[model samples]
Target: MTGARMRVALSARGVEVDDGAGGVLAPWGDVDRVTAFALGTVRYVSFDLVNGHSVEVDDGAPEWDEMVAALPAHVDGGVDDLPAALAALAHDDPVLVVGAPVLPR
Candidate 1:
């Protein structure tokens, strides 16, 4: 199977450089570092019905912030990998928890 690829861009502050013409400043003041990576296929699955009953679960859905928080800390490769990354989060059974809150006595 063909693996997915991704690119990342990083920026920072540094000293300036002079241009060749009469010590003039360079057109582009700062520079950015870009990197690429190849990631294998990732998948995530969620079973809405547990023990043959529909249960309220946290599947990283409903809101963009919640979904983003559920994703892996480090994600790279092409945009296609986004689905796979999300899938990975879904498959991550450890992080999944019941959304219900405990009632006070």
Candidate 2:
């Protein structure tokens, strides 16, 4: 089966105070999850991958909610769908992509 996936970098208008250990933190703000397909024009908070940092964001946005919607639906699809799905991501959002070994069936 065909599949897709993509995640753009998102920018934050908020402050990321450095942790005592020199790490960074995102205290949750607005968020938007945009893929190639948007049920409708979308505008909201965004997140992305950068050293596996964590942040908070609103879930009301189309992208964010859509991501959740796709989870159960993409049970047998490939990873390619991610790119198109994440196209709407805020070009500056920070996110982490952790992958594991999938045993061959």
Candidate 3:
């Protein structure tokens, strides 16, 4: 998440993240889901992989809007209440944007 400017891109293969230092490719078949949360005014988006790891990108990065807009193409249920979820950032809760909505208790 830290490094020059971040770049997030979507492709037929999957989500690609480049932080200027290095890059990570989260393939479509390997992705478990996607999640988003806000800390202060910044929004953090994560691509959760089936292998138990994840890649995160922030709103400060370029292509952030494009990536968010393209989520529905790759993730089930996409982000139905993104505006509302972001509005509730003061509560500091991470919302599930894809796959299932339920979070662990």
Candidate 1 overall Cα lDDT vs. reference?
0.26
CA lDDT, every prediction?
0.26, 0.32, 0.67
| Colliding pairs, model 3 | none
Better of 1 and 2 by lDDT: 2
lDDT of 3 at 79: 53
lDDT of 1 by residue, 15-36 (tens): 1122223221111122111111
Ranking by lDDT: 3, 2, 1
Task: List clashing residue pairs in candidate 1.
Answer: 5-77, 5-78, 6-77, 6-78, 44-87
Misplaced by over 4 Å in model 2 are 1-52, 55-57, 72-105
Tell me the lDDT of model 2 at 87: 53
Clashes of each: 5, 32, 0
Report the C-alpha lDDT of model 3 over 1-105, residue by residue, as the tens digit: 633576778776787877778887777777777777777777777778789987777777667677767666666674566545544555366564655222223
**Tens-digit per-residue lDDT, 1-105, candidate 2:** 011222212223222333234534432232122212222443232233243533333334323554444432322234444534445455454442312112124
- Candidate 2 vs candidate 3: the lDDT winner is 3
As for model 2, its CA RMSD to the true structure in angstroms is: 14.5
Worst 10 residues of 2 by lDDT: 1-10
